[model samples]
Target chain A: MSATLVPVDEAPAPGASRTKPRLAAWIGYAGITAVLLLFAFGSPFFLTASNIATILTQASVFGIAGVGLAIVIIAGGDDVLNGGIDLSTGAVAGLAGTVTALAAAAGTPGMVAVLYGVLVATAIGVVNGLSVTLGLRPLLATLATMGVAASLELVFSQNLKIAVTGGFFEAARGSVLFGIPLVAWLMALIGAAVWWVYGKTSWGVNSYAVGQNPTAAQVAGLDPRRYRLASYVLSSALAGLAGTLLVARLSAAVPGIGTQILLDIILVAYMSMIFSRRRLVSVVGTVLAAVFVAALDNGLTLLGVASQWVGAAKGLLILLVLASVTLRGRKNR
Target chain B: MSTIETLAAPVEPSPGPVAAYSGKKRGTLQASRLVAPGTLALILIVFSVLSPVIFTVGNLFGILGQVALLALAAIGLTLVVRAGGIDLSIGVALDLGALASAWLIHDGYRAWVAVAGGLLCALAVGAVNALLIVILRIPAFLATLSVWFAGTSVQQLLTGGGAPIYLSAPLVPDGFAVIGRGYFLGIDAAIVNAVSISLVVALLLGITRYGRKLTMAGEQPSAARISGLRTNALIASAYLLCAVIAGFAGVVLAARSNGYVPGSGQAYLMDAIGAVFIGATISRYGRVSVGGTLIGVVIFGLLDNGLNLIGLSFFWQDLARGLVLLSILLAAVVLGRAKSRPATGIFALLRTTKHQALTNTAKGNRK
Candidate 1:
């Protein structure tokens, strides 16, 4: 899928212009850092090292999912026709995570269990990819995927939350290095990998082109469909990994877990796009925004606000950010 | 606007090989055959084979009664779809209506007041949705999504952890039950009531000036605007009108159940969307119609009842529904494309702006 760098205007995100994006990314990061520092002072327990670690870990789970979502979003062309949103993302993750737990509980090796989980998720992801390329409208295909994933979750879990009954999450939750949870670092690693791919590779640049203008990409002799397919497959695979991490965090495979977290994942992904070099959705932006969201959620919970209301707050926050960004764009124009 | 103009260019010849295959009348007939009744035929065959017990008129009416609320939601959504827009908030909109009525009824209001309050809530929901899409200029899907999120939150706040509103306390009038379970002559009141609402919508779509402009605005927004139609208002009104009907359905559901149940309307979302889209394929106009939606509703109603009668668990039922929805959608895409090669919003429901900044700024520049 890697295309030779052809230096197209639509393909500039991965190379020569890479240096220009750093400044904008930092500007966004600065806001998030300030909020973190504010919370550190405002909430008595905010600055605690454990709490900081917890927030990062929480953000990382959502961040991994966000990475997949951001990639998929960036892979879509304007003419993609309501094609980019994937409502089934969380469901896919939950299924993968539950399968991993179930596999581990049945005495499969932990590594193998994880492999099995990822593989199953990849298969579903491939199906999603194929559907888009095969001319099923992205919205309907993904909506159907969501339905199937949700139902599959119900069938597998039998409406019950399944505990791993083994050491599935022990390493995920217990292992830490350099003052950060292993999972958080894994999230950073994946984020960096995605950033590198989009910033340094031709295939990544080609995807950017396809997203910008599929006709131009097609005329350039590039297969936009493959890129689109790859995007869905990649997102599904990442969602699978997130599902496993989610199980690790919860120590159980909870049915319908995706329903709760999918929105947040999508929210963080959109936030990442908003906060980043608005022209492009970047990995750094997604991770930073996810962290910010995690901190905000943690801060509100600490203030004794009900989680239900917090859900509303998240939705409102996204709308506010989106509106401001849009309004600002209009003003500039 | 150019894109919209292209869409509004009165039914041009399709651009591909399929265009050369079918004659005009034959192709139109073939496309219409695949929509609503096709789904019904599919359901009737499979379900009848699976469970002959559910293939009866009694079961049919029972299924209709069960899906009355869903039919109402679909009818509302049909208007939105016909306008080249989609609403993801219909489920929450239903909740808003039910909660509004519940609040009024619990406060010792008469049944009529509660019903009025429910309709008012629907109207307000429609207004808010209009402001979001028309004034704020967000895409229809995202606007409704925002409404869904905010409404769900407000609903939670309103209900305080979503406690059910029991009508047992001062008792809802016995006459209220008629809306859900009453009989008119030999037919079930719920079915009749739902059908009557569909009839009114059909008349609006078929004969009224409002309907004409709405069809024009959706199928050809730029053309409609050129002809002095308030396209934005028409789109917003479609949403508002949909919400009001959904609200009415919620009230009836509240009456039937003897209380207002939180989040109960969520299940209707998929079925409503499924019905409308499927309805379009089977529709003679290949546009949204009350008749097409009614058939789709009956199809869905039967599918659910049959699936249940066959003793499939809820999860299995959901899986079946999902598969059925996907297949129907896949077929719709193929048949629709074969009939009209134009790639319009009707087919591209969610393919709007993920990058709101670009879409909005561009839209502003055009204006």
Candidate 2:
């Protein structure tokens, strides 16, 4: 799919001009640095290698998920359509972890458990895609499924702790290559896959075409609905993988663990989309955005800012980034 | 003949590949299929049959009491959405207003004064939203989301992480209690409040010039602008209207709850938006209709009430509600498109009408 309808005046051919976006990039870099410095100066707990690893470890799942979401956004399905929003990612992940836990409990091999979890998560993603394609407002459809999936998790084990009972949890907890968590490795795999599909696969082109101008894409023979569904499904699958890693790390599928996941993921993903310099989303860009946020939060926490104020800071960053994007987009138009 | 000349001709030979697609007729049919009350009716029946307690007076009143806050909140949102904008901050605005009112009442302020103060605060928030979007050039979604987060944090900070403000006996004067709990004729206060608000909004949307202009701006901004409508002003004013209504609703909810809690408004945001969206599907208005919103609220209320009566857990109830919403949207899309396509064998009125028009035009050309 190609966007042939060039809006009368083409804005400087995609990244061709030497004129640098120097200021925005600098501000972003500076913000990252300032937050890191503040953390280093404010607390002894912040400087520990373990703490740094922990922060990055925790940030990986969200960053991985951000890549998928970035695809959906760049593909031309505005996150707002059909009442669309993805609030179910965490729940989807939880369900996947629960499946893995159950299988692990049933004396399944670690590899089998992992496969089961991923498959279930992928199925859930497919459900999400179907609902969206069938014209259910994205939010409502996903919301319903989120509730269903969450409830199913509750009913599955009555909120039991099974992540540890299974060898799968051990694998999740295990370091694969010198102290790096298995979950971090999973993040890398997911990131690499996403990057490949986004940059090297035809799906990548279709995604951009769909997101940037669906009508144009449709005229050029791409099925907009199909691509939209695929993007959502891919996003759900990634989220599911993230969930599996979470359970593997935590050794449990606690019912309430997913409460803040959606908010955090959406904030980072939305912010990333707005700041995507290429006007097309990139895996690198999305992951970096997630890292930027995680760093900020960790830094703030290390700085001994009250936990309550941490949320406010996240909200403030979202405002600043999104505001800049909207303003800049308007100026370009 | 050149393709351009052939396109310029009103009556083309047979039909072009895309000539069958007509926007207005399809829109009307689609709009009719999307009406809100149908789902409400279905849910009401299903719930009534599912639980005997669902139809009981107390439960009905409970549902009404719950819906009042959201209904009020949604009135403002409906106005905003109708004018081609959204207010994610309504949730926070509700929080700020409810707490502000509670604080004032605790500080020995008159209940009415406190309520007014809350409304004013909400209005101020709305004004800020408007200014940010219209003047600062912030997108509606980002601006409102920021305000929402900021307002929520501000309220949280003010409370010092304490519990919500509780009203003393003196603050709950007879008049105030009456508004919160009293019955008007046979209808409870909550019902009365909800109905009255719905009616007022419906009237405003239906008869007012401003309402028409707002709708026009949303439906076709370029056309509206060409007609000299002040699109930005209308958009700003719409947010303002939504804020005031939401503010008032917040006060009412606080009164009903007997205090303002930190989490008071969090749960209602989705419900309010759902009602607005559902309501839009209900009428010819296409974006928002007060009656439709009422129906949406009723449907949701019934579902919740019935589910609770059946001893269903929170998770299942949420899933069911989401399913209903999703089904409604899907049904809208499917049914909407269904009507636009060649109808069934017995209902091929569209084909015939076009055929007749074409023949008549051909005869005139021959003459």
Candidate 3:
């Protein structure tokens, strides 16, 4: 996976030259900040430390899942055939939660239950990876996995919400350090680790190379398929982790839980691209975008807006970002 | 002016993998074209053995009725995919159509007017999709997905918190009921509508210049553009037609259910996509066709009917369907790869390079 294995001249450049003003890249951050300020001014409860903590806690699930999705998109690139996307992230999360909840109810140790849940999700991810590397389109491959995972979730949960209480659940739901939830902390740690791995490691560089142009990467001696497969695995594993945490936070494994927030996860991942300097998906940007989305949802709720409006607002926001990005790209060209 | 001449020039059959694959035998049947029908027959045989009730005329009609809406939706999906785009928001159009028409009928509007209203609403969605993808340059996948996300929320708002709008039996107009349940020539009206629509689409795509150009645009947009084909306009029309057809399906869905069910149309989204792709395996070069999509829909309908008849639980049915879809796709991919590979020769090298160039261009156009 090392870029150094290929001669420097043979490798494709990492990214296009940064010609756009730095201000353009900061639009996403500015938009999030403006929204936060609007909420603070509009609602007295919005600025409270507790509310901030709640937003972070709420954002953790999608933040963790978004990190994985961002990696897949970055490594999958923009090509229609090879571009990586995992439609099963939400289903994987739901299935993992179901597994953990069922195992815990069966008197399994909390750690082992979590392990079982993650392993099941990871195994499904392997299937997805194999499907894509074996030449099935990424969209179709993940879509098939999504269906299988959702059905499995129903089978395991018996179409009923399985409530789990005790050891791990109690800790996950109740634990807070310095007024911040444990899940939020875990999300941050995962994001930071991924950022380092994606930015500072040769594996990360090679993944970018592979995404940029697979044929070129092949010519340069990098195995693009391995990186693509690894990206899917990482995405699903993180989704599994998010699902386990979601179950602990909710104290129940609800059927179709992951599917409910799938749009938000995808939105966070895609929106993060607008924040990156090179318009690529990045860990830091995804985490930030997730928090912003969670905060928007929280603020809208506090303002007594209907949940439906919040969903519509998110869709509109993404469209606005996409339009501006496209227009900007055209102008630059 | 020059562009018009280029467009008027009769299209020369493209020399590519598709032509190469089909060239050797003009009159002979392609084995790939039988995959879907073969799978359908296998399912029919297996299900008939598993359940005594499967062969009953009543049950067979029931399966056809069940597949009608799905067939319409998948046909719509096929057109969009053939025009080089995906429409994830088709369910949105379907739901909106059902809701709008149901609301109108509930308010005592004439059946025809209500149907028109539903289709209009769906057409608006198509317009938004066109603006995003064709005008604003958003990728079709993301654009349609956004519409789906926003559109579902709109449906919820209209329904006042996701409740279904039920039309009581007494208020149900005869015209509306006829669309869904009445028989025409001993066949369900819904089934009749689906069949006719499928035939029309088949003719439109297979015989009309517009249809051929749309397929050409999808397969090779750059070449289409060079030939003076209005690819953007063709793509936009495809989306519009897809939405309208899906909207019609939704209207029938509403009439059949005697109300607008808020999320019922969403159920068809994945199934429709699965059907279209499964149908793709039936084409020599993996192009989608109306006949193939119909067969795919029938296969799904049979699985649902047969599995339920066998007393399999709902979850097991779902699992079975998912596995079936996965195995079919895997088989198709493996078969395709094997067929394309050549043992040795300069001709093989040339073929491989041509195939690579086609794929690369397809990828570039999609971006």
Q: Best TM-score goes to which candidate?
A: 3
Query: Can you tell me which runs of candidate 1 are displaced by over 4 Å?
Result: A1-38, A78-81, B1-28, B31-36, B283-286, B335-365
By lDDT, the better pick of 1 and 2 is: 1
How far in Å is the alpha carbon of A213 misplaced in model 1?
2.1
DockQ of each: 0.27, 0.21, 0.26
- Candidate 3: where are CA atoms >4 Å away? A1-22, A79-82, B1-34, B342-367
| Candidate order by decreasing TM-score | 3, 1, 2
Residue pairs of candidate 1 with colliding backbone atoms: A81-B351, A82-B350, A82-B351, B35-B281, B35-B282, B36-B282
Candidate 3 Cα deviation (angstroms), residue A72: 1.6
Model 1 chain A: ten consecutive residues of lowest lDDT: A1-10
- Looking at model 1, residue A11 earns an lDDT score of 22
Residue-by-residue lDDT tens digits, candidate 1, A1-333: 012211222222233223344443444456567767777777899878999899999998889988998888777742223546666789899999889988888889887888888888888888888777666656667778888888888888888888875554788877889999999999999999998886567777777666654544555688878888899999999999999988888888999888778778877887775664433466777898888899999988887779778768777776765665555434333
Which digits, one per residue and each the tens of the lDDT, describe model 3 over residues B1-367?
1211121121221234434533433343445456667888999999999998999999999999999999999999999988978999999999999999999999999999999999999999899998898889788888998998899899989989899898998888899888887899999999999999999999999999999999998867867877889989999999999999999999999888899888788789888988988888777657788987888899899999999999988887667777887777766666555554421111211122233333444433332
Tens-digit per-residue lDDT, B133-225, candidate 1:
788866577667667777888788888888888878446665666676678998887788788998899999989998989988875565567
Worst 10 residues of 2 chain A by lDDT: A1-10
RMSD of each: 6.4, 8.0, 7.2
The C-alpha interface RMSD of every prediction is: 11.5, 13.0, 13.5
Sort order, lDDT high to low: 3, 1, 2
lDDT of candidate 3 over A159-219, digit per residue (tens) = 9999998777899877899889888999999999998887777788777766655545566
